[model samples]
Target chain A: MFLITNEPLSVTEVEAVVADPGAGALVTFTGVVRDNNLGKSVHYLEYEGHPPMAEKAMAQIGDEVTARWPGARVAMAHRLGRLDIGEASVIISVSTPHRADAFAACQYAIDRLKEIVPVWKKEVWEGGEYWIEGSTAAS
Target chain B: MITVQVQLFAAYREAVGARQVPFDVPQGATVLDVWQQLQATYPKLRTPRPVAAINDAYATLDTVVQPGDLIAYLPPVSGGRSLIPSPSGEG
Candidate 1:
């Protein structure tokens, strides 16, 4: 599944999609708005993405997953606009027959999204906000 | 003839002085044509930015544009949360 939403995402929502009988393992990752970064207190986070480009990139990622794991199920959602503190900005869930595939594929999806998707994350910090470009962050 | 709506985001929106630009190209005008026309019509676009995207993925002049297709013009993703309003590639 590929989605772009403004609604707050929940683990339950993700579990609903991943609770498949055939899959033995489910892996999910959520990127939240951290309260502090670079020694500043963050108020909120704004996730800006090139909708058209980002959507296309997401669909392509799904295709890549299918190619790698023939029968695996993949779902991804990204939140846009201003997100309050502790809110999930992005979530990815993957279900595969094996635990290793589930872990690897889930990591692949999130990493690829960070690397290629035209999404930008801005940290709304105390006094003023700044876009966080954590060098260690995956695409 | 087909009309494709292209939205400019961030720097592109500011440079063009507008949010969305409508390109009414001949029916079956490839995405490339729309891009070239933007440059041609707006001499200011003579210096094209990085790559362009059609319906999301990276596209070139060769990509086709449909009547209702929404194309996006994206600049490199930086930390700036460009509050440029609509017609930004994301809208």
Candidate 2:
């Protein structure tokens, strides 16, 4: 399951999608807004994206995990709009028959989400705000 | 003239002061041409070379613009990395 929402993210919501009786391990990762970045104290964060394309890209990541590990199930979601510091911005969960596969797939899911997803974040710091230029993905 | 919608994100959105805008370009104008027009209108938009998307799919600067096309200008992406091959040749 892949989703994009403006509401706060719920870890249980994502974990439920990866619930599998046959799976031996489930790994979940949540990316939270931090209080500092690049030596600057961040006050808050604003996230925005082309919701349709972002969700489509997220689903593609799920498909990739299944193709690589046939037994793995992936669930991921990203929150859009303003989020206070320490709030979860993204949540990813993966289930597989082995702990190693579950862990690996979960890592891969988050990395791919960062590279291909259309989401962008603006850091509102003490003095001013700036849009972060993280990856140079032209698409 | 062919009209197309330009969708901006992040800094590009702030530069143009709107999330989306409409532009009327000359016939046979390409995606790059539309971007040039935008730069002319909002010089601040020249900060980054954003990835272009034509109608929700990845596109190149050389891609031809069609009437009523929606061209999205995406700023640099953060954190997310694609394992698959992207149109821009990045991972």
Candidate 3:
């Protein structure tokens, strides 16, 4: 259930999508907006994404996870538009037959999402704003 | 000549001040060719070549573009939890 939406994200909703009867462990990771960054007081964050491509990238991440950890299920959702401080910007859920696989796969999903997803965040500070671009070089 | 739809996102979009633009290029023109043309038109696009995609799929800069294709120039992504600091030192 890879998604890019303007609606607020929910961990439970994402978790439900990856629920598996045979799974022994489920791991959910929620990314929330922070109030401060780089020593500046952040007012809010505006996220923009190429929806189709973002979802494709997420699905690709899921494929990678399943290949590495067979029988693992992954689900992810990313929120777009204005997000206030403490609001969840992204959620990832992974279910695996073992706890270690669930934790590792969940982490991999978020890390890969950051690398390949076509979503950008604009940080609005007290008096100014700037688009934040990740450091990873585009391959 | 082939015409392709060029899409920009994030800083690239802000730099161009538009989300989409149309470009006409000779047949066999690659993504790099379109990027050069884009930079020429919008000098503010001073950032280096970014991740490129065609018709919603990731493609190399050397990939040849097709007419009416959607070519996206994606700036460095900032989604999910980022452990690395941004180029501007503000992640």
Fnat for model 3 comes to 0.50
Residue A102 CA error for candidate 1 (Å)?
Answer: 0.8
Instruction: Name the lDDT value of residue A9 in candidate 3.
Output: 89
Distance from true location, Cα of B5 in model 3, Å: 1.1
- Candidate 1 residues A1-139, lDDT tens each? 5777778887778767767899998889888777766566778877777765677667777777767877678888888889988788888998888899988888878766765667766666657655444252322
Q: What's the TM-score of chain A alone for every prediction?
A: 0.86, 0.95, 0.96
lDDT score, residue B63, model 3?
Answer: 95
Clashing residue pairs in candidate 3 are none
Candidate 2 vs candidate 3: the DockQ winner is 2
Q: Candidate 2 chain B, which ten residues in sequence have the lowest lDDT sum?
A: B81-90
Top candidate by TM-score? 2
Show the colliding residue pairs in model 2.
A114-B79, A114-B80, A114-B81, A115-B80, A115-B81, A138-B51
Candidate 3 residues lying further than 4 Å off, grouped into runs, are A136-139, B79-91
TM-score of chain A of 1: 0.86
Clashing pairs in 1: A52-B56, A53-B56, A114-A139, A115-A139, B31-B63, B32-B61
What is the per-residue lDDT of model 3 for residues A40-118, given as tens digits with 9 covering 90 to 100?
8889999999999888778878888898899999999999999999999999999999999999998888878886677
Score candidate 3 by DockQ: 0.34
